[model samples]
Target chain A: MRIFVHTTYNHRDYLKRLYAKIVDVLKDSGVMVITNHDHEGKEDLTKSEIERMSDAGENVLDKMDGIIIEASVQDSEVGYLLAYAIAQKKPILYLYEKHSGAKSVMGYFTNSKIPDSVKIQVYEEPDLPAILSDFLHRIETGESKDLPTIKFTLRITPQIERFLKLKAKQYRTTKADYLRDKVIKKYMEGDEK
Target chain B: MAKSRSKIALLFFGGSGIQTGDGRIFEVTKKEEITAWLKELPELGILADIEPVFVFGGPASEVTPALWSALAKKIGELYPSVDGVVVTHGIDTIVYTGAMLSFMLHNLGKPVVLTTSPLAKEMQSPADSEGLVSDYRNLGVRANLINALQVATMNLGEVVIMHGNRVMRANQTIKSIGPGQNFFEPIGEGLLGKVDFGIKLFGHVRERGKGKLKVDAALDDHVCTMRIQPASHAEQIARMIASGCRALMLRSYSTLPYPQSFIPYLRLAQEKGIPVVCHNLFALKSTRANEEYILINDMTYEAALTKCMWVLGKTREREEFRKLLYRDVAGERIKANV
Candidate 1:
């Protein structure tokens, strides 16, 4: 699978470490990562060169299956890039360093609306590659959680129960199926309760 | 003495819980099904003459300013014939729609209740356990909708959320955050009423308008929001402004001293005649008046974002924009010296 990895220029050392570790992980694997360690292009690059580099970044993002961004660095440009990635509905994994005292990058999505494809993880050094590889494996195997499920207990009277059973018999289905259909019917019913 | 029944209009837009079964498979939802469910209960008829209008169906993310404008228009056209209104919407954007409706209505003489079910579940007869039968099979989604409909019949003269037995003022309502919280909460003054056995309205009920109904459907669509974090780049703000971000909801974790680096960007946005409102999330302490040039006021985070979108829908003029922002259209803002 082809994936894009984005990081701020501030995380050059972290990106280098990630690149080295990932190359080892992907030795025989089919995963291809397009990451530009030189996030901030050459200082003397011409306007056309800069535009071309920006276009190249966007093009890589366009073809990639997903994105992995180093959220540890607090760069607004990383945020801008993430916004574009999200608009594309590509699965995103937000990786941040385990920190103390300083604010966690995880705070970004606390109150913000999050898409189901977005995942955030905090990591310490040695397990970074392992965790990233594991996330990718699960992503490929469709093992990651897709949606959150909620459970609740309901209370209904005997009459409603009998009514449901009778309706189920009338509809030639089990009571559970009948109840589910009724519930669906409720939402379909005009707009009221 | 018997109370006269109300002619209530229930407008349906889509929300999460009702659209899915335990947030999974998309369960079939239709207007007639909802009516059949309601008709099963005899108590509902005693409350009011229920009129359900299936406007649209989608998740909360599908809610747009245009949908809100159309809703305002629908309510205006129907208010003369109906006693009150109830809206079933997605939990994520319920507060936004509620706040928008509050401003759009300006001065609603009758109640406009917005309610959402955070969990929609299916019940079985419990494997030969008719022994454990009672009122234990009611889902929050159904119960919350009934409560909302009941509140709508009461003519509360405000947009509100009726969850379980609690009646929350719409503009003042904030989505509940933190652990184990799923419903929207009323900030500051707390809940407006309770339906323990009967409707118990508390204080803070405003003096409502007595005359004609007014609907402000002229909403500008060029508004957007950006959060100011510890490392939020000013360049992003500059780009947003350049891209015709007519209004901006500049938000922070709290109303602490805003970063000085943001000042130049703020000035640039202002120079382009775009107004900015700094919204404080989960505000505890009072905001300092450092950024006086930018209108800073207290509002439920949901209300601030929705109100920004609502205000933009009408006018982006500097004077009218600020007036709409600061003004408490249907008690959405705190009475501050902004």
Candidate 2:
């Protein structure tokens, strides 16, 4: 799964370490982590590229399966991106460095109004890996309810049923699972609105 | 406690910068679609109550004097209703549009912000893909738009271009040549503001509610612009004059003893009663104004060129055109030394 990680440019030493640790944990778990900082042979994007996609009406968050933001340093850009990701309804994990003296704006997401897709956690450096792993695990296992849960019944013609069976067999999965994972998920992710 | 939001009229002239996901630029053809689109980004709603005003749908390069006139008139019409105006344009000709509007919109009391998104370069390899997603989170159209909306609501009033962190005067803007963080820069003390932790305005800015809005969108597009080269010839000027060119703007060497071969062409333009403007020519010492050509030292090439079109549109008589050209119609030029 693809994940986008964001952090502030402030508090360079602490935040940079926190960012690197998060990337390492995510990478170890086989998650494709996208970040603006250059690391692991990946160069940061030029200003022009960012502007181009933005101009093209493309949001980078749309491509990600999930988002992780380090909110120990409050920043306007971080806040904006968080709001954008939340609006996009992507599963988000907000990490706040414990006792950093900076508050996570996510505190405003009270229980009543907070969407199930958003999770807030405070972490000491040592507990960060576990917190991130649990979040990613929940997302992957659908325990976080990121995947479609409600059941729906549909009638299918014989020709369509044959096509579904063939595609499911080729992919080595049950027809229901194949249709849900490939067709439905793809459609949902690629939907323009 | 909640405060009232500023009502910003977003004059949408379709540019590649503000295009939507359906491969279509943001055009206010349907009110419902525009409303839904705005609802998708609630951040803009938090910043201001944006009313989308459709002007045109095309690349910035296609923007013409007529479009500039229309935009100025639209701003004038909306000035009484909205707190400020944000114009979405293509990055290619956004500076020119900004420059023209700075002149066309007269006695502006509210901010007129022009913004555009840069087009991305083609990715070379698989590794380049990460940059695309990561960069979007940091800087993109959304960040620029947010900053621009905030600038639109600011106390300052003037025509400015917002890109990245820089807020520069429209006429004084020059498109940066190489790969740099900033796409545009101001000329001659032209930076109106910068967006960092918050918007910070430099001292030289027109405050909001200072004057009533008026538009002088008159423009003559028959002006010819030429850059002097070592091998430049006079025949080029003759052809331009023959093709109904009313005014000439020359990008000359910074330090000039102008090439001797171009003297007759200067004389020719003078004899033909065509007004000539020499741009980027720095005087070594105090020099008397040459009747043959008007010298522009401090203005950007885009501003000087657009100003010529504007001045020509206002008048055709040689002396009158010269007078209007140097009149500082907007803050496009530095004050002349007495």
Candidate 3:
């Protein structure tokens, strides 16, 4: 399978490692890679060159089966490229590095803050094989289910829980039943889809 | 044999004559002196013999000892039988005073109308009194019709007589380009109606001196209202959730792109046990649970304000709030009825 790789900012070193992993994952798997920068002079390409290449349509996304984006570094070229892919309605496998402190590109993708259309995976180390295998499996098997759906993760006080229960009772049903009905009714309305 | 007519009390506090973003305080002259321009009302056959009480002060003045007594006398003059009150004030703290008055005058038979302008008096000559005539004329008319417990506030040309409880701001969401006008457009929401005191039709007027005002200032800055926007990040909602906010009003977009970002934050609100009231938007497919939250002012404008006001006054409890939030106000609870 042919895949296009997009990198950002000055994270070329990170991309080289990520690219090598991509090759290792798809060995003998018929995948081709494309980028707008010089292979050896990855150090020489300035921010303008990267931006210019982005503006120049390379026709790579149409030819490739899917897009692989590197979003580990903060405020880099790779993140903008990934955002462009998401906006273009292309299937994107977004990869990023997880950091506990400060805002990370990966956190932005994972937080229930972004649209659900964009799929994201965070890794501590470049484990392309595992990431690629899973992504390809999703494409080949059409089993896009259980792909880590986003959920609101705030703690509820006991007072609030009791309030919900009392409210559910007032609406003439158990809390579980009320929740089930609301979820089903909302989904059937086709608002999120 | 009635000793006097329904008394009209006009109170203008904190009126400003200059221009600035905060110059909404400059509206006292417009709202306070409106009774002097009752040419249209007499033609409409209203306010024919109504008593008129007028008072004015700077924007910083609320209900002061001297001011309150002066206003009280004005009410008595309008009608030794002064049955209602019409107050004109700066927009900034109008709702606070409105809520305070609503709490104090529970089940009041007489209507208390609050009105203001968005422009400064000096921006244009006598500019402060520009819309006063229309607003004052309407208050007398509205009070005469709906006699129910009334608490109202007006901006620009639009007026809303919200129940005492329904007086919360859009946090930093409210934006106004012109003076005295609402900072933000209703965002597909609109005005229900203005307060009037000209007629005596609805039977909302209560027995004289019957109700007590309750001032609950516990809200402080803990309660906030925000509009959900497209692409809004989860961190924004999460921060609010973690901050220990007791209540939040989520002004959802009208069927327009319906900010999908709210889906997750709303869930967070549910998980955190914070009460989230959804207004001005449609339901999403993957939206959290229904019983977990409350929805209001769905499509109609008037219904939402009336319902929001009534609900806000009834309970600070999440469950009770949700119940009241979903219930109909002005009979516009469900879409089918609208």
Q: Which stretches of candidate 2 lie over 4 Å from their true place?
A: A1-193, B16-36, B119-135, B281-289, B335-338
Q: DockQ for each of the predicted structures, in order?
A: 0.01, 0.05, 0.00
Scored against the native two-chain complex, candidate 2 gets a DockQ of 0.05
Candidate 2 residue pairs that clash: A55-B17
Of all native A–B interface contacts, model 3 reproduces a fraction of 0.00
Cα error of candidate 2 at position A41, Å? 31
- Candidate 1 regions exceeding 4 Å error are A1-193, B16-43, B120-139, B178-182, B207-210, B253-257, B281-292, B336-338
What are the TM-scores, per candidate, against the unseen true structure?
A: 0.56, 0.63, 0.36
* Residues B156-180 of candidate 3: C-alpha lDDT, one tens digit per residue: 1112232111211211112234332
- Residue A158 lDDT (model 1): 100
The A-chain TM-scores of all the candidates are 0.52, 0.67, 0.49
Interface RMSD of each: 24.9, 9.6, 30.8
How do the residues B142-194 of candidate 1 rate in per-residue lDDT, one tens digit apiece? Answer: 44555666667554788888764568888788766532213556776547886
Better of 2 and 3 by lDDT: 2
Better of 1 and 2 by DockQ: 2
**Model 2 CAPRI rating:** incorrect
